[model samples]
Each structure stands twice: as structure tokens, then as C-alpha cells.
Target: MRRLILLRHAKSDRPLGIVDLDRPLNDRGKRAAPQMGAYLAAEGLIPEAVVVSPAKRTRETWEAIQSALTGPEAEVVPSIYEAPEAALLSIVQTTPDTAGSLLMIGHNPGLQDLAMRLAGSGEKAGRKRLSLEFPTAAVVVLDFEGDAWSTVAAGTGRLERFVAPRDIKIGD
Candidate 1:
């Protein structure tokens, strides 16, 4: 089976003077990013490969999470910065098969839309919550039946888990 972890970029500072891609993570994002990472590590859900958007917020989120993981290397996908659901799926479908567990840190509504489209079924509450809103720093885990990334397709994944920073206490 192949596991897909879709992580939306953490909360970011508003883009006033800075360009959208250059906006850094806000204080809440900085705290939530590490918390999410620790939660994943504690659950033994580490990914083999991480694909991230080139945006500063996404890159920073990956950096914060990297410390909690063992050896997952990250690749910057410029297209992910503004990609739609279809484009995002293309990137995932092209991932090397050797990467059994894959994590993608990017933006939305692409990430949110992708998760909604790919997930066939799972925990009813989780699916319902995901359908509402994919908040910043939310992590959605989906499990596909096949062993290869190339086999991934819409409505083929089973939602494994869904977590938002609010679901976790930072110091706990």
C-alpha cells in the first residue's frame, strides 16, 4: 500500500509589502508546524520523501518538521506554489515508486481539493470535517491500495487520518 500525507502550508503572515511567495510563517504557524511534526513522529507516520512548494511558508514548515523526522529529504516544486488540484495530482502520480510514504507540503485550495477528490472513504467524522475546511497546518493522511505512485487516481484513496493544529496541544 502507498500512503499519502497532504499537509497544507502553515499559517502565514499577510502579504502587504512582501510578495506572496516570500511571506514567512506567522507565530502560530511556527508553533503549530513543530507540533504537527512531533505528532506524526509519535504516531510513526514518517514519510520517505517530502515534496514542498517553493513558497517561504511551505519551506519553513518543512524545515520545522524535518527535525522530528529521521531521513526524509525534500524537493521544492515551483509549480506547487500555484498549482490546481489536477496539477498537484500530476506531481504525486509521478513520484518514484520507491517512496512508499510521501508527504506533500503545499497551498490550498489545491491541497484541499486534491484531498477531497482522492479520498474515497474513511472515518466518517474525519471526512466530514475535511469537507468543511482545510485549515492551515492541517494534515490529511490517505492510504491507497496499490504499491506504486503511478497507480494513484481520483477516489482511489482511503482517508486514514485528519489533524489540525487545534486538535493538538502544543506543550502536551
Candidate 2:
């Protein structure tokens, strides 16, 4: 089995003079990012590889989680920034079959779209529960039956988990 974790970058500071791609994380994002990392660690969901957007906010979010991830080095892919679901799908398809799990950190609506597209029948209710609006620092875990990333398809993977900072706090 292979697991895919889709994580939307945390809330970003408004871009005034700064370029959209260069926008940094806001205070809430800063706090939520590490909390997310800790949650993943506590849940023992460390991924084999982490693929992230090169944008500043995404990079910062990945940095917050770096310490908690006991995996190979992360790769910052420029194409992931503002990429569509298809683009994200292509990236996943290209991942080596040897990598059993992957963590993708990027923006929405790509992330939200991807999650909905990959959700299985067992998780239909969870799929409905997912806001079309994917909030910052949200994470969606999908489990695929195939060992290869290329074999991942809609309804084939279960939505094993969906978590956000607010859910974490409520559970606490």
C-alpha cells in the first residue's frame, strides 16, 4: 500500500509590495505549521519523501515540519506553486515506486481538488465533510492499494484522515 498526504500551505501574509510567490507565512501560519508537524509525528505518519512548492510560504511551512519528518531530503518543485490538480497528479505519477509514501505541500484549489478526486467510497462522508475551501494547514491522507504511484486513481484510495489546526485544538 502507498499513502499520499496532501497538505495545503498555511495562511500567508498579504502581499502588498511583495510578489505573490514571495509572500511569507502569517503569525497563525507560523504557529499552526509546527503544530501540524507535531500531529503528524505523533500519529506516526512520516512520509518517505516530501514534495513541496518552491513558494516562500510553502517552503516555510515545510521548514516548520522538517524536524518532525524522519525521511529523505525534501524536494522543492517550482511547478507545484499554484499548480492545478492535473499537474499535481502528474508529479505523483512520476514518483518512484520505491517510495511508499509521499507528502505534497502546496496551495489550493489544487490540493482540495486532488483530495476530492482521490477519495474512495468508504470515505464518501469524509469527502462530503471536506470544505470546498481548503483552509490553511489542512492535511488529507489517502491510502492507495497499488504499490506504484502511477496506479493511483479515483475511488481507489481511502481518505484515511483529514486534519486541520482547529480539529487539533478541539481534540486537545
lDDT of each: 0.93, 0.88
Q: Give the top-scoring candidate (lDDT).
A: 1
Clashes of each: 0, 0
Residues 93-172, model 2: lDDT tens digits: 89999899999999998989888888865466667777455789999998989779999876677889888888885245
Show the colliding residue pairs in model 2: none
Candidate 1 per-residue C-alpha lDDT over 117-138 given as tens digits, one digit per residue, 9 for 90 to 100: 9999899899899989999999
Candidate 1 wrong stretches, greater than 4 Å: none
